[model samples]
Target: MNKRVGNQTVRLESKPRIISTATIVGPKEGEGPLRDYFDTILQDDLNGEDSYEKAEKSLLYSVITAAIKKANLKEQDINYLFSGDLLNQIISSNYAARDVDIPFIGLYGACSTMAESLGLASMIVDGGFANHAVASTSSHFSSAERQFRAPLEMGSQRPPCAQWTVTGSGAAVVGTEGNFPYVTYVTNGKVKDYGIKDANNMGAAMAPAAVDTIKQHFMDTGRTPDDYDLIATGDLGKIGRKITAELIKDYGYNMDNIYIDCGEEIYDAEKQGVNAGGSGCGCSAVVACGYIYKNLLSGNIKKALLISTGALMSPTASYQGESIPGIAHAVAIEFGGDKNE
Candidate 1:
């Protein structure tokens, strides 16, 4: 049993399952087409919290507990909690983890935390080191604006290329056994920076990383787009998705029939006027843990590849004239695959 599958991808032999999931979104996301997929939709971003950052922590903690409850497990029963967020030092996940007694592994993968955490959890569970692990992440628009650009109170004018950061959180329970979607393979993406400097145009910055990881996943797994029902990117929005599609197509992956991005699907791009679309750690989190998870549970989608994309840059790096770097982590989940695989 060596589970390693080539350089970047790892095949899981133990079959870790998604026992349960929970998602909470703000009013803007709640108004989207997939509203019913979420477990809770807040009327406002703060929900009486003093600040958007605190609201973000509240969202993460709430979702973690909700997912645990849905799985019929106690907090102490969770062996480990994998979590992350966009705020400085990942304060949202740090503070949220404090309220729970489970061991925590805080991550900072920008928007890719959801998939990153899930892949890691699956690895540990598949290795027989843990029976149950929880993976979760969150993001807030107002808080992101304050940290990345200007506060919303400044009434900043955003360019058409700018995307709206999602204000939401998503949590999921991964365990050794369940009649849920099985985590079969994990592809770790390399950091790919194309000298992008603009903080607003994250899609352009992260598209190359997405393409690189996706192309490698196919190469390593010996599978193509036709092998899976869908390939979903965590965020990437419209601009990034197009860039990824065009680039990966150069490698012979015609994904037009099976590809979609969570960012583009979360908002009504035409009616909402969100410009490019949505981008945030929560953008893909809520969609994957909610919509996609539910769809998998219902057997509507037999196999899916969730590649959560991230822009690995900060306000400090941007101010210092450093170019933005991007990364993407892909996790392959399927239903009723070969029993021994």
Candidate 2:
């Protein structure tokens, strides 16, 4: 039987497989280095919608449909759809679920929502609560800016440490039967706030949380960085990546060569002018579904650990002069190729 390991980690004996996935991104993200990995790329950020919020919803809807289609399943086949976004009330995910007509459970972990969704969906399948489920998350640059920072028209100057919000959505279909990457374990994180009030430096604010989760995951699984082909973190741009590395070393683990960050890999920083790098809910989601998932399917990667970090702060929180709180969730995935083949 699958059982809980340590305090926060759950080991899934059934190994729910991620059978298929889909990704959609805006023009800016389309031009990034990971362009070929995406399933759909919009010509513009608006995506034929009048508002950025609507565009985010459309992205979510398209990605979810595409994921189901890729899995050779229909909307009716999904037992539950887990999704969320950075917008207030998670309106993008809510509206997308309404369009898809699937039983919906909205989640909110800020940008860590993708990992949260994936972890929960995998548990549902492994526990036999549901045979098939979809995990999805999205974020739009414009929408995130308007809600978290400033309106586009305001043209607020971003500080050097600020990361760019990814305008995209990613969805994954998971089930018990498939020759694909299987989720083996999940380590949920606790909220950590270091009392850093600089909204522009989110990487610094979230680094400790990422470090905490990574350390705890290693302890729970009794695995080192060398146990997996790669260990990736979500949205912890260059600054946070460095901080995480140093902090993890301080925790007595050296993750220098085996670790990579989705934020750092998603774009060519110099060419894209993305400052620190990519953040937002879609940053890790798209990279996982598009790049890492494909690699696993092709046997380019045997096993990996994906840790998604999120800054659990809002504009209201910032305005209230509250420190940014951060959280991270990790999932261990192994390639389970076609058995018959």
How does model 1 fare in lDDT? Answer: 0.92
144-209, model 2: which lDDT tens digit per residue?
998888788987888889899999999999999967899989999999999988877888888999
lDDT of 1 at 179: 90
lDDT of 2: 0.91
User: Candidate 2: lDDT of 4?
Assistant: 94
Global lDDT of each candidate: 0.92, 0.91
Lowest lDDT 10-mer window, candidate 1? Answer: 332-341
Error of 2 at 147 (Å): 0.7
lDDT of 1 by residue, 1-341 (tens): 88888789999987799999999999999998889999999998997899999999999999999999999999998999999999999999999999999999989999999999999999989998889999999999999989988978899888888899999999989998869888989999999999999988999999999999999999999888988888999888899999999999899988999899999999998888788899899999999999888888898888889999999979888888999999999999888654223
Give the clashing pairs for model 1. Answer: none
Candidate 1: regions farther than 4 A off: 337-341
Error of 2 at 5 (Å): 0.7
Candidate 2 least-lDDT 10 residues = 332-341
**Pairs clashing within candidate 2:** none
**CA shift at 224, candidate 2, in angstroms?**
0.6
